[model samples]
Target: MSGTVGPSAAQKRNYYLIVLSMISMFVTTSTIYMVFPLFFEEYGMSGTSIGFLISVGTFAGIVSSIIAGKYSDSHGRKPILFAGVAIYAVVFFLFAFMEKSFTMFAILRFIEGFAFYMTPVAITTMVADIFPPKQRGKAMSLYTMS
Candidate 1:
């Protein structure tokens, strides 16, 4: 009686969840992306410095994703996702009060990247958990498009 039980249609796919996840990601990313140059200029950073700031965040994300992926496995997906989102919101809100210190902004950007990485890690893991092996690829594609 313990052979296996593949996802039986309903549990294997959830269009609403995928779409909502995508929309949420879009809003978060766009909010920062659309004002990249102006934000840096107002903060008095040169182009090279701005680029460096972005690079720091990218590098941090690489490290963060590896650690978060492992942590998510043991801690469960929902908590990671929630924490990530919460941290992300707090970081963005802090921007309003951030001083004109490039160093501070760079550090926060790195933190933002780390927190944001958790979202996708948790989401993809949650998707795989819900979908059957056979449908996983397709589900992933749909999620990615979102």
Candidate 2:
């Protein structure tokens, strides 16, 4: 029971997973939104359409977050998280190859909103699960920075 001198391998793994989750969250979210305006503008989308597109994602995110957050508590965080991330990637890959179809983009964005919001709740909870209560705040802060 006295082999290691510093943090255990498990702790290192947990930290690594937490960091990965945070990065995935930021990367997926930022990539979609950061290019939204330029992408839409190229097609001459009106202001109202742009507004509606943004709202569609936001509203879907809210609903997805609520549903996933509640389920994660009873079922467990990791499964939901993995499913969300996997589905999110598939959605993005599909989006990348999609033609200039606004309707398809809108649907994908709705699914994206659902998949994206599901992760933060799970990853945050996993961080809390991995760290002590006193350390959770700092862990969460590190996660949020991503």
Candidate 3:
């Protein structure tokens, strides 16, 4: 056996739970990335328009990630994580059924970015909380692998 002790079972469980959430986040994001370009083009958005829309979403994510990190620090990470996931789910569902328009899509994409980003902020916090500093790097590596 190795000299170094490993994480306790509960620690392992929590770590996996966090990883699972990250995986869910990745899945939703990947699905959007795969589908949205085609959908936008089919909806008659020009190449520039599609690029602009994606940029708006990215900007929203950047802004929201900053806000969310502070909010989660004060209010706690779990609520932010759950709200982000919930909002993302709702937005993704709406995308499937909603009618198309540039304005509407832009608004949804903004919300989607805001929601999509909240998870990583809160999740990284949660991982920090669950794992001791010694294991944190490994935990994050596994988290990102999702």
TM-score of each: 0.84, 0.85, 0.89
Q: Candidate 1: which pairs clash?
A: none
For every model in order, what is the number of clashing pairs? 0, 0, 0
| Rank order (by lDDT, best first) | 3, 2, 1
Off by over 4 Å in 2: 1-8
Model 2 residue 4 lDDT score: 28
lDDT of 1 by residue, 1-146 (tens): 11235555555445456557657866878877888788877877887897898898888888878977998899898788888888888988887689878878888899888888877888888877876677678878877877
By the TM-score metric, which is better: model 1 or model 3? 3
Q: Put down candidate 3 lDDT per residue, 1-146, tens digits, no spaces.
A: 12345567887887688788779778878877898778977898888998988998899999989999999999999899889899999988888887878888889999999998888898888777767777778988988889
Question: Residue 27 of model 1: what lDDT?
Answer: 85
Error of 2 at 106 (Å): 0.8
Q: How big is the positional error of residue 6 in model 3, measured in Å on the Cα after superposition? A: 8.0
Poorest 10 consecutive residues by lDDT, candidate 2: 1-10
**lDDT tens digits by residue: candidate 2, 90-124:** 98889778888788888988888788888888887
